[model samples]
Target: MTTTASYEQLKLLKQFIDESKTIIFYGGAGTSTESGIPDYRSKHGVWTAMTRDGFDPVKYANPQFIKKYPEKFFAKNEERDNRPVPEPNATHKILANWEQSGKDVRIITQNVDGLHQKAGHRYVLELHGHHRLWHCMSCQREYLSEEVKRDEDNIPRCFVCEGIVRPNVVYFGENASKDTVGKARRSMKAADLLIIAGTSLTTPLAKRLIYDFEGDKIVVINLNEVNISPLKADLFIQDWVGEVMTTLSEMN
Candidate 1:
């Protein structure tokens, strides 16, 4: 279902980027699909696969579940931690390049993979938190994911205080970090251009933050239709995010 963008459309996109001084790139899981990461809500995504296997991500990926069943929680996290690391794709590289070229670019992403940082983007706001960061619940001591995974027990314990060690991600019942949200909101509101890419716009947080954008131009790049009512995109391209962004990067 991927469609090719016309030459005129590509020119217009480049024009938008060139004319804007401040830009914000808001992205989702689909942004990293080209890097071998699976999105959550797509037809062949992690959610569908997990559901098919009788694993309820909604129930298990929650704070209450972690508190009630620490062993099960750690088991699931261990599985996640063992997955191969994904590399940055074209979109990530392009955005990082834009920032390096002094385009005043910032990224606000729902992904926890940290690919943006790997691509050398310094101003990234991760709304969902990162899997690679862990902390001791009791001592508030920070630990790398590898450190926690080294534990022999199913439930990871802090070496310092024998307290439970948990990922710094925002679970289903937990709220996102207020500092991150506030910074993202300010960036969106102050941006002259906003690019919404690789997302279906399904999450409430994504929608809410996007609505705060007071930008003059909005561009959406996704293979599927996005229905962000009242806040329509100036340009909507139904295509692969990496493809479109790669093309954009090539333009003058």
Candidate 2:
């Protein structure tokens, strides 16, 4: 249990999941923040480094620019953020285990850390892609996440084509993988309950996905208030995600 969770709250949480058959857990960068992965939009994030470097993150990952001067972008990436060793937190593990019980409908995440997948969540719709895996832009050859991790470079490259390898993640202007978005929408529409944790509900599709669900049951756990309007979440707890999900898992 987290520092904030009470026995009463735990009971309420257990009851919440118990009644819902089809559940979809939507999360954001905040979901992996506790695991030591800095969310790019947070106060202490890669964006701050980009500011010091005198360029916006939006411009940095531009497709045209990346293809034009790949070396510069790749080099800057190496200097800026090469620390990608963040592991799955307790929350990630529990969510994955929840799926093992055949109860978790789907885990829709905005994070690129690939923690949930590593934790063994079988049904996942990674809307924004993940940082762990990489693919050759030229040949479009897929590489295992471990292959990227073994390489010390920030921007992991493809050995065969020697082309610029991009993380599977969706950049600022880049579109998401059509397959991923489709699955997320389908799962969300079928959800009886939506448990959202560790997200500000800010940024592109994070908040918009909530609108897909017509069901009244929505649970949100965030450290700060989300940008969206109105007191509509069925359960809102401003707290740490790792602790909350860990507590909820132990209830059953």
Candidate 3:
């Protein structure tokens, strides 16, 4: 159901890319959709389905929930467990290629999927924690993706202290650390061009960060026009991110 960018838009995007120096990419779930990851706010997103079933997905993702009800917090949902592992697509690859080519390019992502890193981007600031990280609530010991074990209840436990293990991601009730937010803000402040892709601007923090950028060009590429309406971006392209980025990369 998605489409590619038009010729005019592609030409315009390429012009912006060629002119800018310090470029920063602000991305969300949509950035990963080309690799088979679903956006969390979409009609078929994880949060959407949970909300339809009368469950507040954010509450379940909260750190407070884990503190209050460790059992329920650690309870495994088959849906989350069975989520398809996605690879980085053209957008991620193109951005990484830009960074590798000595451009002052940085990535600020709201996704925890780690696809950007997998795509070989070195300067990625993950606003949300990664899914692969597991840490002990008590000792604060970190566990790799393979080290953690699940119990009969599917609750992950720490190997050393037998304490509850939690994902490193930021939940709805919890705000990102000041350091993390500061890093993202710094990148925005330095950017000559800001490319926002695949996000609906639903998160207040994301909106604040985007508006805070005093950049030369603010470009938004997405699959829908509705998400970018309030943005007032210098350039708005309603198309698949990977397609647009691929075309831009080729032109560059």
The backbone clash count of each candidate, in order, is 0, 0, 0
Q: Lowest summed lDDT over 10 consecutive residues: which window, candidate 3?
A: 72-81
Residues 1-252 of candidate 1: C-alpha lDDT, one tens digit per residue: 344988788899999999999999999987999988889988888878878889798997887777678887777666765778788998999899989988899999999999999999999999999978898878989998777743566888888888888889987878899999999999999999999998987878988998999989999988888988899889998889988988777777
How high is the CA lDDT of each candidate model? 0.87, 0.76, 0.82
Candidate 1 regions exceeding 4 Å error are 1-3
Tally clashing residue pairs in candidate 2.
0
Per-residue lDDT value at 119 in model 3 = 92
Model 2 residue runs over 4 Å out of place are 5-7, 79-84, 145-162
Model 1 weakest lDDT span, ten residues long: 145-154
Q: What 10-residue stretch in candidate 2 is worst by lDDT? A: 148-157
Query: Tens-digit lDDT track for model 3 on 31-99?
Result: 888788777888888788778877688787777778777776665344555767678898889889888
Candidate 2 local lDDT, residue 203: 67
- lDDT of candidate 2? 0.76
Per-residue CA lDDT of model 2 for 1-252, tens digit only, reads 245766776677678888989888888877888788777766787777678779788888777767776767778766536675677889888887777888856888887777888888888888878766778888999887567532454456678877777777787788888888877877888898888877777666766667778664888778776655543776777778887877777775
By lDDT, who's the top model here? 1
By TM-score, is 1 or 2 better?
Answer: 1
